[model samples]
Target: MVNWNSLRDELEQAKQEGRYRPLTVWESRSGTWMTLNGRRLLQMSSNNYLGLTDHPDLKEAAIRAIEQYGVGSGSVRTITGTLDIHDRLEQELAQFKGTEAALVFQSGFTTNQGVLSSILGPDDVVISDELNHASIIDGIRLTKAHRKIFAHKDMDQLEAVLKESAGFKKRVVVTDGVFSMDGDIAPLPNIVELAEKYDAFVYVDDAHASGVLGKNGKGSTDHFGLHGRVHIQVGTLSKAVGAVGGYVACGQVLKDYLIHKARPFLFSTSQTPAVAATCLAAIQVLKQSDELIKKLWANASYFRSKVQELGFDTGGSETPIVPVIVGDPAKTMRFSDLLLEEGIFAQGIVYPTVAMDKGRVRFIVTAGHTQEDLDFALNALERAGKQLGLLG
Candidate 1:
């Protein structure tokens, strides 16, 4: 029999270090407010930036898709799984992203893994931002390419690395469009400029920025007006799109190459028809108006300012994702638990996800939250902060 003692010991150590994560059960669809433990809590930890998960249009689209296509795409894209709706969704996504073509994947994680592993080889070099998402890091590890890391958003260090890696067969600079933990945007213009100068490929994972940035949320490339300059753009349909799956927007040649070579796309089943329909509807919804995006930003601004006024440290946030940094891991977890008791649901992020010295409770403000709801959460936070001596 396999030894279980080592796994048990690791679990015990995680618990002792305040890094043990428990699954949270929700009784309702995730929105600005959700049911947790039979209690209604203000959900400030969701990635539903535009609150489109429960939208009537999305629901109607999903229902229509189910009637026409039923559930599940029976096989992988290489075989019999590529539905007409899948093609339509890819066209819609490509148009929205202003790319020659787009290819949908199982998830944001797999998109990174498939794209990176398929494209890079032994003679290639990948320069990544230190704070890029875990998925990107894992994707890089799957490749045989030489890897280098630069300090988070440190353009000078990025340039230095680019200079050093000039002799590689292919040099790619990969970074997250928005840093999830710190809620800061990548310097895309600088990155693009440097990449152009150094003859490197610019790859941006715009997962968090997809529905929260740019003109009607066209993503970081459009947000920074660097359209067509960046080589690859990867984004998720789950976060702000209020659905599921991921996509990589690139030139037609690259899309064709990934279709033939990416293992995940070759082996895994395509997204469900309902999910494809939902994502298409989301893009249409975004094209129609910018009202939800505006409201989301407004809510984020209000919450961040108010929380900072309560003597909480919101570190370097420039978007709806706000992190209240508490240095000690145990105290950070305690603060999250206290907030939950006070009818708020913000998740505490600890070591491995973040540095041990930078444990924080991350809050994601959405368009669905009213001023009154935000005020209520703020009051609860104040009470919890005082109870835990986190405030003066």
Candidate 2:
């Protein structure tokens, strides 16, 4: 038998270093509050920004879809799995994004990986933002293209990199519409200008910004008014849309290319009819209303102001994601635990997620959170920070 002692030791080491992340089960819907291990806690770390995950319309649509289409797609998209609802969702997605066409993938990560890996060859080059999501990094790694990383949202550095790639067959500049960890918006307009000057295509991963920015939540491209300028736009349905899947909104030719060439889309089974229906319902809601988006920003602003007033460091946050830097991993974990004890459910973010010296407790405010909820969370956070010697 293989010795498992080394594995045990490694786990123990991870535990000691406060990097062993154990899962927490939410007993209720991931909305304003959730039940964890029988305790009701104010939710602060969920990505359900618009609270559409449990919306009545979304639930009803899912149920209706189940009655009509059954449960699974049974086969990959390339075969017989592509359902009529999937095409409808793609049409709605393209209409919402103002793109010529859109193609959905199994997930946001797979969308980035598949598109990058399929399109770029060894002769091409990808100039990516240093602080882009890990999915983007992994996708770039899968491609044989020459890769160059520029400083986070630094246009000058990007220009320098693009200049160096002049001899490459094709150059693609990729960046996140919103930096997830630090909650900072990328300077997309500037990046687009530089890309134009350098003769490179601009690709933006608008995962976090999908339902959190732009008019009617069209995402970063719409937020920056760079609609037709960006070559490829990627977003997630799981975040604000509160559904499962990712999509690439581009021209018809690129969508066709991905349909034929992208391994993830071709190999993985299509999204269930229920998911497609749920996403469709969610988008319908977004197109009809902006109330949730306004509420989310209001809650975020209130929470951010309160936290900052408490002498906490909220680094570069312009969105609902507010991170309080605690520096040490153990201390950040302790801070998170104390907040949990106070009935808040924010999680500690440490190394591998962020840098060791940048360990923090990240809170994601949502549309479901009321001003009263924000105040309650702020008070709890202040008390917890004081108990942990994190605040004056």
Candidate 3:
């Protein structure tokens, strides 16, 4: 009756093909350097870009919130969900993003899903980036919108798509402000101009850029000097902020629409009170201090420079997420394993995460990583590359 054996066969094939992504348990802290499998290693794998995940302010705020409001929010925001902390965090995010309103979601993925699905329907057109995050792809799939994906950051292709979007009920140009894997910026000024020319709405998922780009990590909109023009700016507290939630900053009317129409936002339980408070604290740090963000950029620059000098192609990366494009999944895995043994935790990214033959060893640098830490990781990577026949 059940095809359990067939499913098992599929898994076996994937494992044999070197596509298995086994989770490795780490016995350590959420800091720049960590312990994995009983070995202390440099952690260059997390999305904690601004190093705020373990900040005293955020931790203390979460602790205070737990003490006062207990652990969970107990219900969906539509019911008894919106706690006091949620309201405060929303306010802070709205202010930070220069938006009239903002709404929080359970995670960045859900946030993207909510925004795309709620605003677009059949007959609507969604012009998306070819390499936008998987969550955005799924969100577009959920909508009834006709989707057209242009080449990554190729404004010409985007404009061509917009030119051809004349028959839809509405058109929305969606993109990731910072390409998560490529670490390059979206050609926003061109995209924004094209949207205006085509009378289309603009949406940006700033998951990777929220606390890495722009002044004090205000995000890509601010980075590009186009503050209020973008209709939706979706961000996650899970990345640079190091908390656990998502939000969409937009006009009051748009936020109102999502509150009523977005199923994920309406049905999902509120973020834990502790999470909301920690997010607020993280935003406060971003708003008031640039020290950590500065450190993050410094670390990124140093690491990128070293990687390039080592003759590893980083693939147009302009941020902390660096990709060592290793072509074959097996080679990528071998490179990762070699680095793992040498105490660097950069992982191999292959297949579904990226297209076939584009497998890479994706490295992430953090604000907390010291020069010494970066040097250690670089040395390990050099040896790994040599051992894997990837370099001199």
Candidate 4:
């Protein structure tokens, strides 16, 4: 038998470094408030941007799908699992994104992994933003393409890299629509311009921006009014859509190529009927109105301003995903614990998720949060910040 003692040592070291995260168990649905350890805590760490998780239409749709199609998709999409609902979801996604075609994947991470690995070749080159998500990093790693990194949203460096990589047969530029940790929007317009000048294609992972930005939540491309300029757009159904799965919106040819060449799509089972239905309902909900998006922005602005007034360091935050930067990992975790004691549940993010000195407590305000909820959490944050000497 293989010895597992080394694993325990590694875990112990992680714990000592304050980076060992234990799973949090919640006894209730993911809403503005959730039950944890028999106590109600204001949930500020969820990515339910539009609060569609608890929407009546989504819930009803999910139930109807379960009744009609059962609980699971029994096979991979390329096999027997391509249900009518899945096709409908893809069609809806393509229409929503204004793309010629779209392909679904198991998760946002896998979507990146499969699409990048499949599309990029050894002779090609991929230029990535330094602060891009781990999924993007892993996807680029899986590709045999020559990789180049530019500073986060640095247009000059991107242009420089593109100029330097002009010799490659093909060049692709990839970036996250919204930097998850800092909550800063990517300079996509500049990127698009640069890609055009360099004869490179653009790929944007819009996981955080999918249902949180643009007109009627059409994502970053729509927000920036660069619809057809971007070559590839990947987004998650799990975040603002309040469902599970991921997709790549691109031209029909690329979609067809990925369908055959993307290993994850071929190997993994399709999303359940209920998930597809829920996603469809979410799209409908977004299309019908922007009430939830407006409400979310209002709450986020209110909460972020209050936190900043309390002297918390919110690093480059331009959206609902706000981070209270704390330099020490241990102190960041302590700050999270302090907030929890006061009935809030903002999660502490440490190294690996962020840089060592950039540890923070991340708060994701949602549309479901009332003014009262915002005030209550702000009070809790103030108290916690004072206790930790994080506020004046």
The C-alpha stretches of model 2 lying farther than 4 A from their native spots are: 4-6
Stretches off by above 4 angstroms in model 4 are none
Candidate 2 vs candidate 4: the lDDT winner is 4
For model 1, name the residue pairs that clash.
none
Against the unseen true structure, what C-alpha lDDT does each candidate score? 0.95, 0.94, 0.90, 0.94
Candidate 1's C-alpha runs over 4 A off are none
TM-score of each: 0.99, 0.98, 0.98, 0.99
Supply candidate 1's per-residue lDDT for 105.
98
Over the full model, what C-alpha lDDT does candidate 3 score relative to the true structure? 0.90
Model 3 lDDT per residue over 350-376, tens place: 887888799899999989888999999
- Model 2: which ten-residue window has the lowest total lDDT? 21-30
> Candidate 2's residue-wise lDDT over 1-392, tens digit each?
98999999998987998878888878987788889899899999999999999999999999999999999988998889999999999999999999999999999999999999988999999999998999999999999999999988888898899888999999999999999998999999999999899899999999999999999899999998898999999999999999999999999999999999999999999999999999999999999999999998998998899899999999999999999999999899999999999999999999888888899999999999988899999999889999999878
Model 4 CA lDDT for position 234: 99
lDDT of 4 by residue, 108-137 (tens): 999999999999999999999999999999
Clashing pairs in 3: none
Give the alpha carbon lDDT tens digit for every residue of 122-149 in model 1: 9999999999999999999999999999
User: How many times do residue backbones clash in model 1?
Assistant: 0
Cα lDDT for residue 128, candidate 3: 91
Model 1 — TM-score against the truth?
Answer: 0.99
